[model samples]
Target: MEEIIKVEKLTKTYGSRKAVSNMNLSVNRGTAFALLGENGAGKSTAIECILGTKRADSGNVSVLGYDPAADRKTLFEKVGVQFQENNYQEKIIVTELCEVTASLYRKTAEPEYLLEKFGILDKLKSPVEELSGGQKQRLSVVLALLPEPEVVFLDELTTGLDTKARRAVWKTLSELKEKGLTILMTSHFMEEVEALCDEICILKQGETVFYGAVDDAIRNSPCNKLEDAYLWYTDMEGTADENF
Candidate 1:
C-alpha cells in the first residue's frame, strides 16, 4: 500500500513536559488507522503536530507527500478534519454555516447531499446552537466531507452518538474507506476501532507501546479481546469500564 501520511521522530513539548516524544507512524492510502491512548497520553498533541496546527519542536511530518508545516496551503486542499468540538457563530443556521464552509473550498460536495446522508437535512433551517449534541456531531461530519478530501482526520468520531447513530456513521465511514478515502481517527470505543480500523497505534506517555493489527494486539497481550488488550497494554488492566 502507498504511504499517505508519515511521521518520524516527531516531538513536541510544553515547558518541561514532552507531549509527544519521538513519535513515528505511517498511514497507508485507502485504509482507516486509529490512534489509541488514554486521556493526556499525547494523542491530541501528536495530531496537532501532524496537521501543522502546532509546530513540533523537532522531527519530520508529511501528509499526502507534502510537508504539512511548510506546505499546508496546498496540502489542506486535499485534507479534511472534524474536531471533537466545533464552535459556530451564535444564531448561525445550518444552511448558512454550510454555505460559508463551501465558499472556502475550490470544489465541494453538495451540502444537501451530505446533510441528508448524515440524517440531518431537516435541521437545515435550525440554528446550530439549537441542535442536539448528536445532531451537532453529525453536522460536523457533514461539514468535514464537504471538501471531498482524500484523507480525513476525525477526533472522537462518534462521541455524542447513540448506538444507532454510531452504527450509521461507522457504515458511512466504512463505505468511504472502501472507496479509497484514508481515515485517521481517535476514539475510546474499542468496538468502533474493531469495526472501522485496519491498523492501530496505541500510545502510552507520549510513546508508542504497540502499533499493529487489532488481532495482533490481542495476541500480544494476555487478553483475548481488543478492549482487554488495550487495558493491558496501557497498564490499566484492573480498571473498570468507565475508564474507556
Candidate 2:
C-alpha cells in the first residue's frame, strides 16, 4: 500500500486544553482508514487540523503532499467530506442537490447514476425536509461520491441510518475502495469500524493510543468481539471512535 496521507507528531490545543498530542497517522492509497476515539477525545480536532480548518499547536501534517492548514483549495477539491449532520436547504429537491455537488468536479459522475447507486432516484422530486432520516443520510453519501474524489472523509457516516441502510452504505464504500479511492472515516460503532477500516488510529485524551492494522489491534486486545476489543483499547465502560 502506497502512503497517501502522512502526519508526524501532530498536536493541537484549545487554550490550555490539549485536544490532540503526538499523533502520527499514515493512510495508504485506496485503503479505508478509521479514527477511533470517544467524544471530546480530540477526534474532531484532529480532523479539523487535518482539513486546515484549525491549526495544530505543533507537529506536522500533510495530505497529498500539501499542508491542509495553509492551502485549502487544492486539498478540498481533491477530497470529499460527508459530515455527521448537514443542513441542506429545505426547498432543494434531492435531484437538485446531486446536480449542484457534481458541478464542482472537473469531471463529475452523472447525478442520476449517483442517485441510483444510493437508492434515492425515486426520491428525486422530494424536498430535503421530506425525506426520512435514513434516506437523507444515504443522499449525503451519494453527494459526497459525486466528484469521484480521490480521498473521502466520513464522520459518523451511519448516524441516522438504519441497520439495513448502514450495511448498504458499507457495501458501496467497499466498492469505492476496490476502485482505489482512499477513505478516512470517524465512527462510534466498533462493528462499523471493524467492518470498514483497513487500518485504524486510536485516540485517548487527544493522544494516539494505537495506530496499525485493524486485525492486529483486535488480536492484541483481550476481547472476543470487536466492540469488546474497542473497550479494552480505550479502557471504556461504554464508548466510540472517529470513522468515515
Candidate 3:
C-alpha cells in the first residue's frame, strides 16, 4: 500500500504544555485510519498540525506527498476536512453553503447527490442554523465530500449523531473507502472505529501507546474487546507502544 499521510517526531506546545509530543503515524491510500484518545489527549492538535492549520513546533508532516505546512494551497485542492465544530452564517441555507464550498475546489461532486445520499436532502432549503445537531453533522460530511477529495480528515466524524444516523454515516464512509478514498478520523466511539478503520493509533498524554490493527490491539491487551483494550491501554502505567 502507498502512504498517503505521514508524521514524524511531530511536536506542538502551548506555553509549558505539550499538546502533542513527538507523535508519529502514517496512513495508507484507500484505507481507513483512526486516531483514538480521550479528550485533551492531543488528537485534535495532531490533526491541526497534520493539516497545517496549526504549525508544529518541530518535526514533519506530509499529505499525499506534499508538505502540508508549505504546500497547503496545493494540498487543499486534493484534501477535504470536516472539523469537530463548524460555525455557519446565521441564515445561510444548506444549498447556499454547499455552493460556496463547491466553488473552492477545482472539481466537486454534486452537492444534491451527496446531500440525498446522507439522508439530508430535505434540509437543503433550511437555514444551516435551523438544522438540528445531527442534521448539521450530516451536512458537514456532505460539504467534505463536495470536493471529491482523495483524502479526507474527519475530526470526531459522528459526534452528535444518534445511533441510527451514526451507522448510516459509517455505511456511507465504508462505501467511499471501497471506492478508494483515504480517511483519517478521530472518535470516542469504539464500535465506529472497529467498523470503519483498518488500523488505529491510540494516544495517551500526547504520546502514542499503540499503533496497529484493532484486532491486534485487543489480542495484545488483557481485554477481549476493543473498548476494553483501549481503556486498559490508555490507563496503563507504562506505554504499551506496540506496532505491526
Candidate 4:
C-alpha cells in the first residue's frame, strides 16, 4: 500500500504537560484509520499536530509525501476536512454554502447534486441558522466532500445525529472508502469506529494502549462487542452493570 501519511516520534507539549507523547503512526492510500479515545484523550491534539493547525514541540508529520506544517497549502488543497464545528456564515442558505464551498476546489460537485445526495436538496433555500443541529452537521459534512479531496479528516463525525441520520451518513462514508478515498477520523463511539474503520488505534492517557485489527481488539477484550473491547482496552474490561 502507498503511504499517504506518516508520523515519526510525534510529541506535543504545553509547557511541561505532554498532550501527545512519542506518537508514531501512518495511513496508507485508500484506507480508513481511526483514533479512538474519550474526551481529553489527546485525540484532537494529535490531529492538530498532524493537520498543522498546531505546532508540535518535536516530531515529523508528512501527509501525501509533504510536510503538513511546511506545505499546508498543498495538503489543504488535497484534503477535505469535516470539523465538528460549523464555520460557515449563518445567514447563508444551504445551497449557497455548498456553492461557495465548491468554488474552492478545481473540481467540485454541483451544489444541487450534493445536497440531493445528502437528502437536503429541498432544504437548499433554508438558511443555516434556521436548520436543525443534525441538518447543519450533515451540511458541514457535505461541504467537506465538496473539494473532492483525496484524504479526509472527520473529527467527531457523528456527534449529534439521530440514529437514522447516523446510519445514512455511515453508509455514505463507506461508499467514499469503496471509491478509494483515504479517511482518518477521531470518534469516541466504539461502534462508529468499528463499523467505519478498517483499523483502530485506542489511546489511553495520551498513549497508545491498543493499535491493531478490530476483530483482534474484540477477541483481546474477551467480549463479543467493540464497546466491550473499548472498556477492556481501557482496563475497565467488563460489563458496565457488573462494574457498577
Candidate 5:
C-alpha cells in the first residue's frame, strides 16, 4: 500500500521539556490510523509538527509526498483538519460559516450537502453559540471536509458527543474510509479506535510504546478489548524505548 503520511525520528521541545522524542509514525492510503496517548503525552504536539503548525526540533515529516514545512500552502489545499477545540464566532450562522470555509478551497462540496449529510441541515440558520456540543462538532467536521481532501486529520472529533451522536459521526467517518480517504485521528475512546482504526500508535511520555495492527495488539493482550490492550502495552517493561 502507498504511504500517505510518514514521520521519522520526530522530536519537539519546549525549553527543557521534550514534548515529543524520537517519535515515528507511518499511515497508509485508505487506512484509518489512530494516535493514542494521555494528556501531555505529546499527541497534540506531534500533530502540530505534522501539520506544520509547529516546527519539530529534530526529524522529518512527509504528507502525501510533500514536506509540510516547505510546502504548507500546497499541503493545506490537499488536506483537512479539525482541532480538538473548534471555536467559531458566536453569532456566525452555520450556513455562513460553511460558506466561508468553502470559499477558501479551490474545489469544495456544497455546504448544504455536507450539512445534510451530517444531519445538521436544520442548523443552517443556528448561531454557533446556540448549537449543542454534538451539533458544533458536526459543523466543525463539515467545515474540515468542505475541501474534499484526500487526507484528514481529526483531533477528538467526538469529544463531547453522546452515544447516538458519536455513532453518527463514526458512521460518516467509516463511509469516508470506505471511499479511500486516509484519516489520522486521536481520541480517548478505545472503542472508537477499535471500531475505526486499522492501525494504531500508542504514545507514552512523548515516545511511541506500540505501533501495529489493532487485532494484533488486542491478541497479544490478556484481555480481548483494546482498552485492556492499551493499558497492558503502556505498562509493559521498557515500553517507552521499545521500537515498533
Candidate 6:
C-alpha cells in the first residue's frame, strides 16, 4: 500500500520542555492508525505537527505527498479533521451545519447521507445546543465527512458517547474504512482502537515507545487487553517486565 502520511525525526518543544522528540511514523493508504499515550505524552502535539496545526521544531512530514506546513491549501483539501474538543456555533442546526461545511469544499458527499449514516438525521433541524453529547459527537463526524475526504483525523471520536452511540459510530467508521478512507484516530478507549485500527503508535514522555501492528504490540507485551499491553509497553506505573 502507498504511504499516505510520513514523519521522520519529528520534534517539537514548548519553551524548555520537549513536547515531541525524534518521532517517526508512516501510515498507509486506506488504513486506520491509532495514536495512543497518557496525558502529556505528546500524542496531540505530534498530531498537530502532522496536521500542520503546529510547527515542528525539526524533521519532515508529508501527507498525501504534500508538505503539511508548506502545502496546506492542497493538503487540507484531501483530509478532514475533528478535534477532541468540539466547539461550533451554538445556534446552528444540524442540517445547516452540514450545508455550511459542505460549501467549504469543491467536492462533497451528500450531507444527508452522512447524517443518516451517523444516525443523526432525525436531529437535522435541532439546534446544536439542544443536542446531547453523543448527538453532538455524531454531528462532528458528519461535518468531518462532508468534504468526502480520503484521509480523516479524529481525536477521541467516541468520547462521551453511550454504548449504542459508540457502536453506531464504529459501524460508520467501518463502512468508511471499507470504502478506502485512511483514518488516524486518538482515543482513550482501547477497545475502539483494537476494533478499528490496523496499526498503532504509543508515545510516552514525548517519545515513541511502541509502533507496530496492534496484534504484535499485544503479543510483545504479552497482554490480552490493548490497555494492559499499552500500560506494559509505556512502563506506566512501573509495570514493565524484562520480557516486555
Considering TM-score, where higher is better, how would the candidates rank from best to worst? 1, 6, 3, 5, 4, 2
- Backbone clashes per model, in order? 0, 10, 0, 0, 0, 0
TM-score for every candidate vs. truth?
A: 0.95, 0.93, 0.95, 0.93, 0.94, 0.95
* TM-score for candidate 4, residues paired by index: 0.93
Mark the regions of model 3 whose C-alpha exceeds 4 Å error after superposition.
Answer: 237-244
Displacement of the residue 200 alpha carbon in candidate 4, Å: 1.0
Please estimate how well model 3 matches the true structure, expressed as its whole-model Cα lDDT: 0.91
Per-residue lDDT of 1-244 in model 6, one digit per residue for the tens? 9899999999999999899999999998889999999889998999999999899999999999999989999976799998868878999988888888887899999988988888888898999999998888878888887888989999899988998889889988988898889999898898899889999999988988899999999888667767788988788564644343
All models: lDDT? 0.91, 0.83, 0.91, 0.82, 0.88, 0.88
Clashing residue pairs, backbone N/CA/C < 3 A, model 4: none
Worst 10 residues of 3 by lDDT: 235-244
How well does candidate 6 match the true structure, expressed as C-alpha RMSD? 2.2
Cα error, candidate 6, residue 41 (Å): 0.7
Candidate 1: Cα lDDT at 171:
91
Quote the lDDT for 134 in model 4. Answer: 84
TM-score of predicted structure 6: 0.95
Q: Candidate 5: deviation at residue 231, Å?
A: 1.8
Off by over 4 Å in 1: 236-244
Model 4 lDDT per residue over 1-244, tens place: 9998888988888787778888888888888899887777788999999999999989899999988889998887798888897677888887777777777777876777667777677788998988888888888788888888889999898888888888888888888888888998998777788778888888776788888878888777666778867876766644433232
> Candidate 2 lDDT, tens digit per residue, 159-222?
8878887888888888889899999999998888887898999888887878898888867766
TM-score winner between 3 and 5, please give it. 3
Q: Which lDDT tens digits does candidate 5 get at residues 84-189? A: 7876899998888988888888899888888888889998998889999888888888888899999999999898889987888889889988898899999999
Give Cα distance to truth, residue 16, candidate 6, Å: 2.0
